[model samples]
Target chain A: MTTQPNLAMRNWNQRVGRTALYLVLILACVAYLVPLVVMVMTSLKTAGEVQPGTIFMWPENPSFDAWIKAWSQACIGLDCRGIRVGFWNSVMIWVPSLILSILAGAILGFALSRWQTRHAGLILGLVLFGAFIPLQVVIYPLIKMAANLGLYNSFAGIVVVHIIFGLPVLTLIFSNFYVGIPVELINAARVDGAGFFRIFFGILLPMSRNILIVALVLQGTGIWNDYIVGVSFGTPDIYPMTVKLQTLVGSQFGEKEYNVNMAATLLTSLPPLLLYLVSGRYFVRGITSGAVKG
Target chain B: MATIEIRNLTKQFGAVQVLKGIDLAIDDRDFTVLLGPSGCGKSTLLNIIAGLEHQTAGQIMVDGTDISPLPPDKRRLAMVFQSYALYPTMTVRKNIDFGLRVAGLPRAEIKERVRVTAELLQITDLLDRTPARLSGGQRQRVAIGRALARRASVYLFDEPLSNLDAKLRNDMRIEIRQLHEDLGATAVYVTHDQVEAMTLATRIALMNAGRIEQYAEPQDIYDRPETLFAASFIGSPKMNLIPGTIRLADGVPVFDTGSDRISLAHYPFRLAPEDGMPATLGVRPEDVAPDAQGIVARHRLNEPHGADTLAWFTYGETNLSARLEPVAARALGAQATLGFNLHKLSLFDPKTERRL
Candidate 1:
């Protein structure tokens, strides 16, 4: 009929609209990628070539010397060692802190969401409210508490500080996710002779893979990029990579080496970047799915 | 199997009372169904028995053991949920064996039990597939298999077939009845459907507004309902109730409808009606017939069901229905005479609404 021609005309108009939309999206992607491209190119340039005017230009003689110097020979405070000096210390602090904090958050979340304890609503509200308070407001009190416990400027002190800050957001994420699961599943498990820990570990935990990955990537990035906590709580020799990198770049009364600073910054960001690259699919899916109730 | 007794069980949510002093007893291997409409506290009572919810004030005795203080995991029971709450991430095999695995049974024994349950449910091919891959019926079968693998003494079902389609629901109904017969487990099921209560329950506890109206066999409930609510709630087209006064004519009790008088000498009453007392007469549709020597009435409508035809007519100011043969129903015109089977009629006291 004559309606077929009208349908064809509408289809043509839709095609034009789609093309224009894709063109705009491509432009936006390029705008976001420019700063990352500049960082990589600046890291490759030699020390003398990294002048203020040529920051975004391609390196004239691209070499690995700046990377080698940033990794090994750059001076930071009294230590002449590069950002590599704090690499193992960061790993030590990050691994234990990540594991302990995630476990505590998950258990607390499961208990708060599933159990019928008195004042559970109050407890969850307090935790969510604690997430909004800035860390700088409580840093002095936290330092005083750590000193009273005789754990100030130590590895344990830094690990505890990371856990205290991470608990609020991690617990909020996990509790919100667990609240969406069906109550019948928990009842069925209880009727199957599963106790509290058994139901948590055997049934609920296995089905929480997506949310677990989301929590891991979030906590990994947050702990990896942390600088204030490390500088305040860590001794000179036990500084995490972020603290060491900051001191390396912000050295006063010394020649500023822009290439080494750029290289070290890139190196410090690689772990979290790799984490996102490897598990980006689950991150987006987890966040969107966890937002809505099943 | 175990005998279960619930003594004066009551539950309250804030100020609203959901279950008000319920008492029930299930014999060994009895399929007792708690039947009621939604918000009637049938499912709430079932949850209390399964230890999922604690009763506000009551004692639940399982084989002479009071389980009031115990957690749900300590109670040796299994439940089939309406949602078929199989673990989504696990395969059917793992789902069936999850209880056994948590109970610390040996691996070989757990595997054998799961195999036997799968074969019994005819889901062997689906053992490796996750719950997401199975259809609704298949997931329900896996849930039942999970409960069966536990071998618990008491099994609770909370409207398990409500999620299935109509055809699948009927098929699963028969399947569940057969499963109960084969296993001979003491089962307590909950449903709001009267047909399900009639077909599947050995004893049906009819509940309304957080109270049990009647607890009897299905035939007893249909033929001799104890209360007015039970009488109206159990039938398909509903029992017709006509209000009148009981008076004496020549020393014989008669129902006077102010338009016509009917003799009640052949009607069996639990207590004889006094003269000059208000009464209501109840008759099923099947008990009325079209006859030559009967009350003359004008036909209003004819509803042709598959098995029979229901003809509606006015008697006095009350409309009444009669179940007639399809062929006979087709022959009816605008006017017909209706006969009531007087011996099968029920008489109720208007004040108490109880059988007289």
Candidate 2:
């Protein structure tokens, strides 16, 4: 048995360690939240109030003028209309890109993991290799190919680029998920006369809700935040919010409007941020689902 | 009903050979069991028959049609897995009719087949529940109902009852046997439990190390084991194999274990053995009894098994086990005389391990 004084000393050490851990955690949280707090306070300030030495101060007379200007009246190049055009473009690009990529990824993943085909290993190796290649390396060739198909500087071109880039990683995620399912279940389906498409639609698809949610959150965020692909493949008429936001912030000639820029930045990021907050629980669960045997 | 013929079925994984040329034939409506320990290729053989695994070099004929090239669904075979691989997302009713639906049967026909199968398996009430909501036994019944609804020509069971508790296993074993008899269906079951093999199989193929040692009726395999391995593998307390020598006394053969001699005058010899030949005597624990006119042995231990008792004895240096009645077990003594039932004695050649 431990002595009374020794046990008390050990308990004191544990208390000190726990307090130190909490102190570190609170400091880290404050450090991360500072920038976000500054953004909100700065966006609330009017043009005159948003000046130097007022970074952490509250807005003296808060108004929605900056927000309204960012939404409908800000200028990018020659257009006086604000980022609303880019917001609609981003939505149009993201929806088709998300759906087509997820459908293709899920089917390819199911086939690669379950079916015994002649070139399955080679196909899987190629897909894995494709996932590691940087998007910048293939951007020029994809542009040339899109131009040949009469799709460059168009809305379809951006959606197609996102789908192509999204396929490799999404397939890998879905393939890993499918591999966690027991092989006996697959065999039973085969014995039950369920062919390739039937097995996917009937059995495996219904059980893939968690992994599909994961794919949606990941791909939605990536495609929405993409600026290079959007600006490179799209014309000014079809530029997504990221590209339009860059033009709105960096193209000003005089008297830079910090509040308007901050408001536009916040507006550009709100959709994906809301998406993550809404399904954050499912996102964590999906990532950790197959890690442990249930 | 279908007859399965497996000719020279062999399987190899890289350099390791799992099955070395197995050949067997099953008659229509016969319940044939492949009984062996783990890694003995019994499950591999069942998979080969079920078309789940391809044999290295073999031919499998079902009802005289070579089905080696067909897929599992085309082979007219249904399998019940050990894990009861029920589709977890669907209701039990959908699980039973999945195969029928896949085969493109009409709606009314699929419903009727599902109803008949559920009634036969007595799982009618469980049809609406999903597999996740059912108990272990109920899940097993649904699995069986799934296969029964398909009404395939042959049913393959891969250690179906091994997952149940003791009492449940016994109950399921009887129910499976009764189902086989009622439907007159051919079944090829694989199991390691000898009691399951003994109680359920019409014929037991005793296997060891990727080869069948003996294939015969259960009682024949138990009473007249053709090899030493078969003799030791089939008994509960295990057959006591006492090494001895056959000595000719006045031209009549007698087995001499160091401490005692037993006359083999009434022993049916497949072939007459030479004098002074080394042999091993195999006698089951149940065949040895306590008697006054017999060889004496020191009583070492008594194990009470509810209805009967097993007494261990030492004769010279060789240990023996005798199954005794409750009354005989009550008469405790330091030493006792034991008699070997001569009709049940098995003589094996020591070198070849084969019966002599």
Candidate 3:
């Protein structure tokens, strides 16, 4: 009889705690959504309606004129063309950079994990050290090196820069993942007449679905959103979407067109947003298995 | 099938010597088990034989040819790992045919091998499924099938059934023994489980502290362990080692535990017994029984295992156990007399801890 009342009291307390938890979660969701909502509303509104008092208000005259303007007619420095040029360049740059970096990282990670040789630890430590150093610290030297190699202000320059920066983290993640796999598996493969590349492609690569997705998402978003590397290494013609967006927002003349700026900003952010939405589940799984395992 | 020889195999890991000067000659078509507890370097010795691990100093000879310099694959050996080590991404069919394909065998030959292997393991229906989809026993069968499919010169098993439940381990143990006989292949198996070692090994190399303690047939090892380590390590209930001394009562030598005197006339000692020499009396639980002419013991505990009762008793300050029938166990009251079968007991020199 005493336990019954105690159980009831515990149930009531649990209910109160659950309600408070949901309340806090809902508030956080609203706080996160408010900026995106405001951007959407401002992008839809005309120049006259976009003011401080009208920030929370819906667009009374909603249209795609700002989107079309941002996509085509917005001026980015000397080029009066839209961000589409940067969009295509970003796509071309991202595809090759992501592929090359992930491939190099996976091979290096597999080799380090399976085969122990002299300086393996030192090499891993150096690569991880590369990941920790601020990018600004090495950007100047890389720019000079790119110039010396005739890659400066070229299409390949930005791609190569992204790959170099992407490798350290990508290699670390991949190596950690591969290290978690049982040594017996590698030994078994070796006994089965599989050499280095054969075991990697046939055995290890096929099993790297989740970790590959994680690497893709990481390097994809990284390369796509990159601004400083693109501006530093790439010419105006081959500038990425993020750099082009910055040019459009900053180069606006006379009265600012907030709608077009907001539209371009949202457009610039869409690919990574879509990537997260698509691979978010796998990304969580990969991080837990690879990074958090230690 | 061919004979394999390991001569002066030694492995050093940093400061610790894992395998210190190991030598063994395995016969053709023999199931040789490297049996020991963990850290005994049985697995390392197996790896050295397979060429997976490079020995610090050794030569592995198969059919009198030194294969020590060859890599694992070129050594013509197949290994079934404890974890199964099945490629999780590949189907069972691909997993079995992996080696043959790597060897550049004809398409038809690879297919035939896969079919034969899958059929042998009774996993033909599971050929299309990946290892992730298979149960543990099925995976183990596939691992065995992969090794069997290769038809290599030597087969190695590294505690393959230690991952399974007790019932499944027994079933797999029988299957492995059957397969060895069926194929007549030269095999080396490593396991810490004494039951697996005893049941599967045609010739058992019992190891301790990086050295082989005893190498003989399973029954011989059990009946006549050369060292106290072998005697205690092999039995489940554990051989009881009673500290005693050898003294001459009249002319015949007798082992005198502090409280009880046991005759050593029937003991097959390698050395002549000396008076007042320190010794250990090794007695297995099953060899002890209730007898009127035995030493008096105070019954301490009774463990009624279904097959037999293991009644634990205290003789003076030493604990002794007797494996008896349940009825005989119940008849053992607070105080009972216990006798050890004379012929079955082992007499170890206390100083050397070896059979005397």
lDDT per residue (tens digit) for residues B147-257 in model 3: 999998699999999899999999999999999999999999999999999999999999988999999999888988889999889887888789889999997999888
Per-residue lDDT of candidate 2, residues A1-294 (tens digit) = 669989999999999999999999999999999998888788889998876757989898888789889999999888889988899999999999999989889998888887666687788789879889998998899999999999999888888888888888888888889888887787787888777888889899998988898999999999999999999899899999999999999975978899999899999999999989988998889889845522
DockQ of each: 0.80, 0.61, 0.64
Write down the lDDT of every candidate, Cα atoms only.
Answer: 0.88, 0.89, 0.90
What is the Å distance of residue A233 in model 3 from its true position?
1.1
Error of 2 at B266 (Å): 4.0
In candidate 3, residue A202 scores what lDDT?
Answer: 90
**lDDT tens digits, residues A32-76, model 3?**
999999999899988788755478899998988888898998888
Arranged by DockQ, best first: 1, 3, 2
Worst 10 residues of 3 chain B by lDDT: B264-273
Whole-model lDDT for model 1 versus the true structure?
0.88
Best by lDDT: 3
Q: Who wins the TM-score comparison?
A: 1
